[model samples]
Target: MGDMITTSEQQIPLAKRIRAHIELADPITWISPAMICICGALASGTATGFQWWNGAHWGLILLGALMTGPLGTGFSQSINDYYDREIDAINDPTRPIPAGLVSLNGARANWFFLGFATFLVSLIFKDAMITALAVFGIILSVLYSMPPIKFKKNYLLGPPAVGIGYVTVSWMVGHIIFAPITWQSITVAMINGGLTAGMLVLNDIKSVEGDRQHGLKSLAVAIGVQPALLVAYTIINLCEILFLVLAVMWGNYWVAAFIAFAVIAPIYSQIKLYNDASHKNFMRYLIATNPFVALIQIVSAFLVGGYFG
Candidate 1:
């Protein structure tokens, strides 16, 4: 009985411990952020749509996009844990960093490991250009997450860098999806990046307290919560207006209408969400609108791609 009790006690805690590490990833919240990059690649210059139609090239593109996003996300997350070690000890002591499934040195080492993996796959794409961009991504990922250079702590720069960087990186993945890239492909890529950046700024609102605790001056902190959210929605709405107008002009009235409705529904939801804004409510509020904008962009891309393909 004593031996059995000891083994059971040990096993249960280890299982609980593993679950804690998984929770640190915030996987539920991170799903779209990771997949959106893949969708962006599909929308811009689908790996499957390439003329070369070779397995090896498509493998590289697919592997690169997957690594550039989630792996980079993992690195950024590790760094976030490193910087927020103290913060996590306060707000989330059960997390891996605080509970210790990952050591400080281990997190740093893992961050670099993923960062290096990102570079290796990026190098497999369009010569040194893709490789250079990959290097920039790693630098920025570390820069945003680490202390003394943690851009996520900044209001003005953080959101744009994260969002825009995500979009552009995805687009660059698309560029490598094809060889001898063209002007049209690059334009679509930028648009994808721009719209994604817009959504990210809005997301910073929900993280305000956590960011503020760590001296992270996110948009909500820089401009107060309500106004920052208002500005975020305002820009988001404006993008919707532009998208619809351009779609109509190009005779893609269907896309314009779809976007028009998609944008409106979120505005309505946000208006309702703001009225009672508790911490729980604000986190819930974040759920109502953030990913839809990127979803619309990705949807629009597929629509365009299908129309042309």
Candidate 2:
């Protein structure tokens, strides 16, 4: 037992533990939710005609970003890594947990700490609605990864769960920081959720092998890869087109024009992905095209907030 403990300590050396903890939190995945949170703030600030130049206002916006990004998202990712460690062992052995860089107990502690921090920070906003939304976000994040109700096990439920958590909830939190959420904000946020769901469909492709082994019905595992790609790209493109139509109908021709232009590259990449449908191609497509997806969301937020205001 003493030798085993020594080996374990050697596996996760003390000096490298901080970096391992960060890796377990998966900071790279925080970008989308963080940016969307900021977009929510922008939309609310615009719609409410709030003073955008106020330093306090900007500070609040940054705080919301922190909740969604590092605190909330960090909680989500850490918990997910804990629950999905078995899957990760098969799919990505290099991950901190599977790589033995972080012990399972350490991972559990990390997520619990993050979840508690997220809750505490939400209270700092001093709004019941914001606090409620924050609680809901935490619950959703837990449901997405934890047992029995692990939403990620069901192809139909999983992607949308993530979308709502990562995009819609984050947006709502940001919006509520500055103003009450309106129908327009809710609608646009849900639209972004749909877009995220579509992207997540493609994301499942990389994990198909492990998903199949674990009986997780991810889109790529349930449907053939090529067909899943088609479905994903269709959902993505349709969401964009819907947003474009909404912009035009709202008489935001500049936004519409920008959306139209922004979509071309992604569409081109989609065609390439559709033809090949390999994991490498999927990564390339996401890296090359997802920026436009983000740009569209930001532009759509401005359109909705400006016109509706």
Candidate 3:
């Protein structure tokens, strides 16, 4: 009984540490990128009348899409954690690296392995577009985190870099996986990119102190949090409004309605952000609205497919 109790005790802390590493890898943030791909797939498939689901390897395609986030975005996140360890020490010591839940070398290994795996998986789909976009995504992820090219240090470029990598690249990869490229796919990618950039800006709201201390010029660090919040809101609201208008133009009332409902959460979060720019409030705003934000791409799928009508 004593031996068993000791083993169980050892496992408990190990499990918690593993959980922390995974959290640092950020699986939750992966959903948006993966869903963005699916959204593009739905839109392109609908427009091109391509039967993506009818293929023998459709399961592989789905797997590839799911892997998009874990391999691409999650890898980028780990690299960011590795590079940002010093900043995290100041702002979020509870993070895996700073807390010693995961070693710096472990994070770097994960980044390289995930990047290679992500690219390898794309080849299984045998689609040139998918491969191209996957390669582009890897490049962008490296540029975002690796030294001397860390776009994350620039307030003007950082958010947009993440947005393009997460939304635009993923979206285009999904679009061309089984369908011909179309203007609809391009437009949707652009819109999602802009909105995702806004979301990245909002993410910076919680990192202002760390960023400023680290000499990182995130928008929130460069400008005051309030103005950064305003810019984020304006960008998000504008893209959403553009999406609504485009949905109406496409006769996608369902999509428009979905977007309108989606807008409510951001509006409320903005109100909360305006009320307080503290990290706690920003975290609250994220928790209150992130799932809703993930659903936006899903709604885009429905919109393009005209599922409501």
Candidate 4:
């Protein structure tokens, strides 16, 4: 049986191998960071009065989106899967590694390739700040999953690491690609980071069983699920309220009104989840609420770019 399994692993066809590599990258998860990148670019461009129709402006936007979405995020997810293969065996045996679709060596090679590609692409912009941010993102990605500093093992560290990597860095990279970093952009990015951190806490709820089995101290495991849900709800609501305040302060009443209206459903979803606090309910909450979160980020970007610029 062992020999047959090894033989099948070794004989995976080239097309299937390629598909496994893409699965390791988890392209669906790339959309959020990519959309954030687009928001950043749009915000910066609007603020700076950049010619929207100009090819160069669009090119920069495209490059930024590619770097954050595919290369940077791909590296993060691949490394995470490699390190979490054992946990995945419990939580989701069908993942590329545990399912034997991708060999361990293949996963390592994919992450290294994506990380190197991210670095090389960052240099193409010829901006020192961009290069530095790329390097920071790469290091954070490595630390988030790798041993000795596996952030995912600590409830305090894991979610923030993901939030900073996914939201803060992506937003800053997009903004910096077009304009110098500004207080407004940084502030909004951090608020989004807080939002992401909150969402990540909820994300852990779905994997609580595997996480507890593996002794990984995820938020849901560290604290009871109900308490963790409250923490997540608090963090999320606070960030949204802060953003609404900022929109009002920036005199973007349209953005403020939009936030006020959009927050209603998510708040209700949070209440529903708080009542049940089960993994099944959490999944439903995510589906019901995440789109509104994305819309808030998009509108907030416009608010900062239009008013702060």
Give per-residue CA lDDT, model 1, range 1-309, as digits (tens). 011111222334666654644454444534544555455445544444543256765565567556655666666666677777776666667677666565555456666776777777776664776677677777876677776778877766776677656666655655555544445445555555566556677666655676677687877877787777687777667766766775776677678788888777766567765665466666665676556666676765565444433
Q: How many backbone clashes does candidate 3 have?
A: 0
Positional deviation of residue 211's Cα in model 1 after best superposition, in angstroms: 2.9
Best by lDDT: 4
For each candidate, what is the lDDT?
0.62, 0.84, 0.77, 0.86
Q: Where in model 1 is the C-alpha error above 4 Å?
A: 1-30, 44-58, 180-185, 303-309
Listed in order, each prediction's TM-score against the native is 0.80, 0.94, 0.86, 0.94
Per-model C-alpha RMSD: 5.8, 2.6, 5.7, 2.4
Ranking by lDDT: 4, 2, 3, 1
Clashing pairs in 1: none
Model 2 residue pairs with clashes:
none
Candidate 4 accuracy as TM-score: 0.94
lDDT of 1 at 40: 45
In model 4, what are the clashing residue pairs, if there are any? none
The TM-score, computed over Cα atoms with residue i paired to residue i, of candidate 3 is 0.86
lDDT of 3: 0.77
Distance (Å) between predicted and true CA of 267, model 4? 3.0
Candidate 2 matches the true fold with a TM-score of 0.94
Candidate maximizing TM-score: 4
